[model samples]
Each structure stands twice: as C-alpha cells, then as structure tokens.
Target: MDTQGIFDSSSTVRDCSTIFALSTLLSSVQIYNLKENVKEDDLQHLQLFTEYGKQLKKDNGKKPFQVLEFVIRDWQYDYDYAYGQSGGEELLAKRLEITEGMATELRELRQHIRSCFERVTCFLMPHPGFEVRKKSFAGEISKLDEEFKTALKELVPSILAPANLTPKLINGGRVTARDLFTYFKTYMTIFNSNTMPPIESIMKATSEAALLAAMQVARELYETRMARVTAGLSLPRPALQQEHVAALQAARAACIDKNKMASTKDVNESLARLTQELEALLPQYLLINDGNLQKALGEAKDAYEASVRRVHGADLLCVHPSDLQTIHNEAVAAALRVFDARRKQYPGIPDDNRTKLLESFLPRLDELNTLNNEHNRLFVADAKLSFMGEVERLLARDPPLGPYEFRNEYNRAKNRAVAAFKRRRNMPSTYYADVYEDDLLRSIENRYYIIREINRNT
Candidate 1:
C-alpha cells in the first residue's frame, strides 16, 4: 500500500492511521453480512473490539497487519452506511472525503469568511441587509462560467449601486472630527486593498460624497439662520437683542469648526466664506429694537435722575437756598434735553454708535451734577456767615432810632435772616419759629442798652 501517498493526499484528514486501523478490524468481522439488517449497538461493540485487536497486533510487531485491519474497518463502515440506500456509490464517495479534521477545518474557514464579509459590508456598503444581498449576488455569479465571473468583477461597479453616502451623526447630533476621520480612514483602507477594484472605488467615492453632502446640509442650515438674522436686521432699532447676536455668532463659529475637517479645499473655503459673510452682516443686523432701546434709555434716565437727586440732597446740607435751587433746575433741564435728544436720535442710530454716545454722555452728566452740587454747597456756607455779619452791623447804629421803629426794623431783619437760614438748611418754615421770636426779643433788649449808652455819651 502506498501509505505515504494516501497520507499526502488526505493531509486535511489528521490521524488517518486510526481510520486505516479501524477499517482493517471491521473487515475481519465478516460474520456480519453486508445485506443483513444489523443492530446499531452490535456494530458499536464490534468497532470497540476492532480497536483493541489493532492495538494488540501493533504491540506484536505486526505493523502490516495493523494497516490491513484499518483498511478493512473503513470499508465495512462505509458499506453499512451505504447499504440499501439510493445513490449508495455517490453517497459513499462523498462521505469518504469528510473526515473529522476536514469538517472542523471547513467550519473554521466558514466562520472566517463570514467575518470578512461582515466587515466589508459594514465599512463599505453601510446599508440594510447589504451583506445578504451581496452574498446572493455572489452565489449567482459563482453559478456562471469563468468568463461570466471575470465579467462580473469588471461590471461590479455598474451592477452594485453605491449606497446613499450621507454622513451620520454619531453620539447625538454632535459629529466630531474624530468621527469623520474614522469613517474616512476605514474607506481609505478599503480603497487601498486588493479586493474588487469597483468596490474599492465605490467606498472611496462614497466617503467623499458623504462628506460633501454633510457640508451642503450644514451650509443650508447655517445659511437659513443667517438669512433670518439678516432679515431681522433690516427692521427698525430694538428688534435684535444682545442674545440674538450672540447666538448668531456662536452658530457661525460652530459651522466653521465642524466643516474644517473636510478633505476638500472648496468645502472648507466655501464654509469659511459663508461664515465670513455672516460675520460681516453681524454688525449690520445688530439693530436694537424699540423695546430694548427704550429699556436702555430708561435705565440711563433713571441713573441720571438718581444722580441728580443725590447731588441735590447733598447740596441741601450747605448750599445757599437761591444757588442750590438754580443748580438743581439747570442740572435737571440739561439732563432732560440730553435724554430727549438721545431718544430722538435713536430713531436712526446704529446700535454701536448709540452705545458709544450713551457711554460718553451718562458719566459726564453724573460728574457735572456732582461738581455743581459741591460749588453750591461752598457758596451757601459763605453766604451764611455774610448774612450774620450784616445783621450785627445794622444793630450797632450810632444815632438812636425810635424804640418801635427800631424794634420793627430789628424784627424784620431777624425774620429775613431766619428765612435765609431756613432756606439754606432745607428746613421747614416752622422749624425755628420759636427760636426766632426769642432771638428777636433778646436783640431788642441789646439794642436798648446800646441806645442808652449812645444817649448818655452824647
């Protein structure tokens, strides 16, 4: 027997020696007729004994006997299975090739092939049931001749339509640069492989197509938003607030960053240009609406009024009654004129310019009010001393006036001084009424002594 030849031919069938030995042992059991319907348990017991007999023969140095025993056992096993079956010869021929080792190898090979098909389908095709459809197409091609197989490979590009290659948003709606790069890298690998050239081209083309599609979609969305913002800008002041402008700016920045990963210059440049246009329009569209403008103006007016009130309150502590009133009126009138003019000017004012004007005007108004109040306070303090001196001078007359007339004159002058003091101090009319009467009596008595002295000296 050409044992070496047999082993080489059935290399996939490992442990062929066992099969050979088992076959020889089964052939020695010739008592079991090939045509007889034998019980399965009896055959099983007989096979076990055959193995024992083969081992014994091998131990006795009858190696040739062992080979013959294996061949006989194999033949009998085949005969028993094929007996009384349809197409027995064909069945035996097919079953003979399927050893335990060959079956295991075939199963493993099937699993590996399935994995490869799945990876190709997911990475390149990326559609529903694409693997199954591809497998079916492959089956059909395999049934055809060698020429048809060659043509299939050449015609695959036309036969298999490219999947819709729109970029998908992974991990929510945020598509990062990493996500896009990963997809691009996967397709690139397929493109560089030795697989079907048509499929590789499809993968490369789809990757590009998807990126472009994503850019277009993003462009349209951003453009629509920018259009709405521009339309809003066309309206009168107070229409757009700071938040609206901020949102537009954020959207523009996001669009730029998202599209920056695109492979093509045109896509990047186009997105950048759109963003630039949006940025340019941003200033123009940032018109403040009437409500927002009024709100800001109201705040400024409130601040101005509060400042004026504070200045007036501080001035009242020391300002001359007359000068304090004058300063207060002027400050109020000036603030009103400025605020009114601002309100009127707001009709056609750009938001930026309006903000600049307000920034300049409000702080100046506050400072002016503060300075004027200080000036009035100093003036009033000086005036109080001057009025006191004037009263004392009037009471020291050399020529004595009549008693009633002197009393009346002194009372009038004292009342006038009291009124001035009350006005300067921001006090009510009744605040020093009692004190004024007492001071008047005292002044009259003092005037009597002075008049008496003057008469005696004369």
Candidate 2:
C-alpha cells in the first residue's frame, strides 16, 4: 500500500499508516513492488506494522499471511549479472545479503512482521522470460510482455487457487460479508478522524452491531406476532393482558435463544425494547377503557343515588337513624355491581378499574347521605314548631275553665299534641321527642297554677 500523500504530511502519513495497518488485517496475501532490490529504505513501509503485531498474535495465534516481493527489472542481463537457473527465492535471499546496509533492516523487518503476522512467508516473483523497458498501465494487460504475463500467471493462481486465500477468519469462524463491511466502515471512520483504529475498538463495534441487530429482530418478532394476534382490534382487558404478556415472553426468549453469544448488556437492551413495545400496545386499550371507566363510574353514581332516593324520598324526611348506614351499604354494593358488569371494557393492567369507580362513587354517595340528614333535621324542626303551636292555642283560650277542669283539659290536649308529633315524624330516635314533650308539660303546669291563683282571688 502507498503511504505517501500530498496533504498535511504528518496527517497524511498517519492516515496512510493507519490504512496500511488495517489492510494487513483484511488481506490474506500482501504484495510489495520494488524496482530492483530490497533496499534498506524500501523497508520503511513495513515499519508501520510494529504496534499491530501483538494484536494480530492475539487474534490469529501463530497463523500468518503470504507476502510477495515483486522485483521488476531484476532479470535484465548485464556484464555484472546474468540470468541463471537458480530458484527465485534463493536468488532474492542472496541479493539481500549482497546489498550494502540491508542486513539489520531486513532482520528487523522479518522480526516485526513475524510478531504482527505470525510466521509470514515471503515469495519472490518467478523469473521473467523477456525484458520490457517502459512502465505499462494495468488496462494494457493484453499488450504486456510474455515475461510479465508469465509472472502474473504464477502469482495469481498461487494465492487465488482453492483455499489459498480464504476469507478472514476470527476465532476459527469465517467472517460474513456484512461483518467485513462493518469492520471496514469502522476503520474508515477512525482513519478519517485522524485516529488509529485499535483492534479492541473494531471488536467493540462488531459486538454493538450484533446487539443492535438482535434488538431489531426481537422488536420485529414481537410486533409481528402481536399484530397477527390482535389484528388491529381493541380487545377486552383480560384477553389483551394475556396476549401482551405471552408475546413479550416469546420475544425475549427468541432474542436470547437466537443470540446466545450476546453479552448481558446486549440481552438486557433487547429485553427492555421488548417491554417498551408491549407497553406501547396499552395506549389504545387504555383509550378505549378510559371511556369505559368514565361510563362505569357514572352508572355507579346513578345506581347509588337511585337506591337512596327510593328509600329517602325526594324531601328526604323519611330517613330514620338506622337508615344512614344501611342505605350507604346497599348503595355501595350496587355501585360495585355496576362496575363489575362493565369490567371487561376497561384496562386492568395497572389496577382494577372497579377500584376507580368506587373511589369516585363513594364520596358522592356520602354527600347525598349528608343531604338526607340535613332534610331530616328540617323535619325535626317542623315537628317541634307544631308541638309549640298546639300548646299556645290551649293557653290563648278565652274565659279559661275552672282550675280543676282546666287541669283535666290541659292533660288531654298535651297527650293529643304528643301523639300528633310522633305520627308526623319518621326518625325513631326519641332523644328530641322526649325533650319537646317535657317542654309542653312544663308550660301547661305553669298555666294551671295561674288559673288557680285567679280563682282563689275571686
């Protein structure tokens, strides 16, 4: 790979270095083109592999890639050197030894590449048949010399044949095309950001991608199953509840089952998404149920008040002491029945909708009961007034009867007034009734004494 570019030299240098570094990871076979010899300076490009060696060793163990050293113009016959029958590998090694100031660099290059690529095997291009003077473009393959053609024929099949250059393998498993694309894309992003993309980052990106894909699959699976089950229809609370829970469990199981290799975080993220999707189904149910809840509450209130009215009457004067609690109990029971009858229409996931109806209905029921008591108080007040009027009418009689006769008539009148007061009232509690009767008798006694004083004076 070329490591020289025209931009900011340092920036471009790092970019190119990073590119070369990642390229080693992707390639099964790496090639280096040289003009004549493996000079000391030519090894500079290989120096970039220094830091990645440990990472490569960890990933691939001792396995290595094939490296081809393609030396052009080396086969040209001259007075000092001539073509021989020696093997290309032997000739290249001999030439490296002869080159000045190349031994140390070559050894270091070998060591570094060994660490980075494990046991990399270097191949010299096969000897060419004939010499060509000019550089040729790749598009002119047909016009190239027979010697160049022969070299390519030997090189291409050596790497491309059968399992010679297999796809990148990680932990003994071949990487899929999708994984490879993700890797390259990650590397490019890091390269563009002027950062060296570490192997750890690449692995992390791969893991994140797997988790995201798993979450998506789980989400889709859950939605598909639920959609088919519900068919865009708003189901009752019990049916919806059963279906939601089952679908959520199956989706979570699918995510876990399909990606058993996923980490805890990955699995948790996918499960969280499933939960969210399950809850999403509830809004429609809630919307429909909210209306039902209101309707149920209204019905409960009406039922409670209707029962209260049947016993208390519109004036509410008929209520007795025991009627307060008894009426409330019966009303509450009726309200509960109202809610229970419509329970299927409301969402019950969070809480029983019946509770909501009772919460609202009970308070209003109490208020109605209070109104009944207030009206009953008015009834008691009216009875008291009527009793006082009868006593006053007896006192206002003209030409009062003689003392003994007046006493007899007063007793009879008081008895009749007490009976009349009792007849008009419904509250059986006699606490107020006794007090009013005592007041009437005391008033008549005072009148009787006054009549006796007048008779004695005459």
Candidate 3:
C-alpha cells in the first residue's frame, strides 16, 4: 500500500507521500496495491517518487530500491477485462500499452518507473473471500482454486526470489544498522523542516561516517597487535620484525573481511587509510630497533671485556705474543657471539643496522689487542732490567780474582739471574727470557774482565 501523488491538493495526501518517500530510502522491495486496473494518477505519483529516487542515486552511489511489484487486487470481479480471455503475455502487453492520447502522462510515468526500478512485475490477485463465497472453501490452500491462494503464494516467492537481496550501499560500503539510524534521522530532520536537503550533503556525511567506522576497526586491530609485539620494548630485531609483519597482515585481513559485503571501492578506500596509518607507525619501530641494536652492541662490548678478564688476567702480554693473540681471538669471538645473539631480525627491513654495528665493534677489538701488545712489551722490559741488576750485584767484588775464578763467578751469577727471572710470575716466553739473560751476562762479563785487569796492575 502507498500514498496518493505528491502533487495532490490535499495536505494530508502530500504529507503521506512525504512519509512514503522516506520509506523508499530503506526499501528493497515495494508492493503497490491496485483496485482493479492501473490508474494514470497512480503512475504519476509513483513516477514522481521514482524521480526522487533517481536524484538520490545521482547524489549517492546507488539506489536501495530493487523490486517493484504491482498487484491488481479483486481482479476476479473483472476477469474478462483483467485476463482479456488470454491471460498471458498478450494481456500484459495490452494493459501496459500507451497507444491512446488520454494516457500520454501515464506513458511517461511508466517509462520513468521502469527506469528507476529495473525489476518490475505485475500479478493479478482475486478477492480472498471470493472462493469462500462459492461455498467451496477448504481449510488448506491445496483445496482452494489456484486463483487467489496460488497468486498469494507466487507473489511472496517472487518478491523474495532475487538471488541476493542486496542492502543499501553508500560510497562502496554496505550501510550498517547503526548507519540506518543516522540515515533516518537525517532524512526526518530534513523532512520535518519542510524541505529536502541536497543529495551532496547527505552523501558526504553518511559516506564519511561509514568509511571512518571501517578505518577505526582496522586501526584498533593493528594497534592491539603492535602494542603487544612492542610491549617490553626489548624484542630482538628479527623477532619484532616478524611480529610487525604478522600484525599488518592481520589488520588488512580484518578490515577487508569485516566489510566484505560492502562495495569493493569502499573496502579499498578503507584499506588505503589503514595503509597510511601503518606507514605512520613505521618510524616508531625504526627508532626502537635502532636503540635496541645499539644497546645490544654495548652489551656485546661489555661481554667481550668480561670474557677477556675472566680468561686472561690483567697481565695480558706476560705470555708469548701468540698466546696473547689466542686470548684476543677468543674474547673477540665471544663478543661477536653476544652481538649476534642480541641482533634483531626484521623482515623487509635493511640488515644494515646489524651489519654496521658489528663493523664498528671490530675496530674496538683491534684497539684492545694493541693495548695488550703494549702491556706485553712493558712486562718483558721490566723482567730484563731486574735480571741485569741482580747479575751486576753478584759479580762486583772489592778484590778481583784470577781468570778461572772470574769465569766461575760469572757462571754462578748468570745461573742465579736466570733462576730469578724464571720465578717471576708475569714473565714473557721462556725463549725470550733466555735471550735476554744471555745478553745481560755478556755485558757483565766485560765488567768482570775490567776488574781483573785492575787487580793484575796492582
């Protein structure tokens, strides 16, 4: 059932038509009741509404109106006129024909309604009690004549026959129940104002609202996942990177899946906004990874120092140079391991962060090795000086002895110096120690010879 034409002089009729217009915004299938035949006034009113719908479609993306069915009621009363004795395509064509000049207005109206609503169907319905009046009425529908009961049954299914009963769509997204409230409120406000708002205003407001809702959903999911992934702010680079990737995938899927029934264009737009939001989040992760990696490098350096101290005491260069090299190698290896363990792996992110940090640390290890070399040189020098001092003290005498006695004194002093050098804990290699000892003894022997020459002259 519907209202009279919007142009009706009756204020109540116009008001009712306005209400009908509001219903059109939400309608998927509209059933128009006809007394016996299609009237020119009825077509004119429907055409006016169809024009309004077209305006809506122009302003918005698409129309919600899908099916329009005209039911000719009590058609059994005029069976010959209604069926035209053929009751097939011939009847329908003859009824809808506009060959007469009196129906010029109706021709235009029918054309307009057809353009607005693509799926148009008409059904001939008889009075429900007409069968009972014949005293042949049965309780069940199968007992009744196929006219009234069958027509009702067929009308219901036909109205619902569309494979997909699509809902209203704005922009590209499907209008949700929450959106319906806003839509009705907007339309009623304009309607109550006694003026219709422009289509642009309505479309813009509603479309933005729908798009925002979609974007919000995506952002919330993305944020939740990212927050969990970065909560401690200390994830390994690779682990954090993997989590970020997973978060992005899940966010996109959620946005698309949630709005799957929406227009493809609308869904894409929402996804685009989500992409932008994800882009904005990237800088934060970069900073975190950068700081984390630096901290890792520092920890690696500390580990290197600790390992060195644990394996080789403070006197690093006291052993053979090769042994010091071995200690340095072990410490450096341990430090590299520490750095590697701390390094994070980020997918699609550059490996330069880890690579650069590791590279920078290598120079520090080299510097440490140099420091050990210097320490070794000082230890060997100190040992040689102590040995020489001891030999000089042993050989010096107030009265110089003969050559054989001098030789024996020299050998005794030399043996004692060698023993003292060996007793020092932080000594260099034994081969190095022997080389220094021989040089010190040669110098002492010359002094002994001078002493002997002085004794002989006396």
How many clashes does each candidate structure show, in the order listed? 20, 1, 5
Candidate 2 local distance difference test against the native: 0.57
User: Which of the numbered candidates is closest to the native, going by highest lDDT?
Assistant: 3
Cα RMSDs, all models: 25.1, 17.7, 12.2
Ranking by TM-score: 3, 2, 1
Candidate-wise lDDT, in order: 0.41, 0.57, 0.61
TM-score of each: 0.29, 0.38, 0.46
On TM-score, the leading prediction is 3
Task: Indicate whether candidate 1 or candidate 2 has the larger TM-score.
Answer: 2
Please give, for residues 1-458, the per-residue lDDT of candidate 1 as tens digits: 12332234554333333333223222211222222223333233233333333333333322212111011111233333431222233432342233466656444433332222111110011112233355556545345544334433433443234642222332113334554454445445434543323422433343354454444445455556645544412333443444345555565555545543334675566557655655565554344334434554565566556655664465544433344445455555555555444453334446553455356655654565465556444444444455456546655667755566656665675556555544554333323334333443455446556654543454
Candidate 3 has which clashing residue pairs, if any? 172-263, 237-344, 237-345, 238-344, 238-345
Clashes of 2: 1
Query: Residues 1-458, candidate 2, lDDT per residue (tens digit)?
Result: 33343124456666666656666655545555554445555556666554444444555464434343434344543233322222445555554443456567566665565555433333444334323334544446566666556666766676678856656643333455665665566556555656666656655554555555455556667778766654533335566667767877887776676454446877787778767866787665556555666776777778887877666454444454455667678888987777666554434454455556567766875676576556555545565556456555655667656667756765776566556555544445534435344554565556656655654454
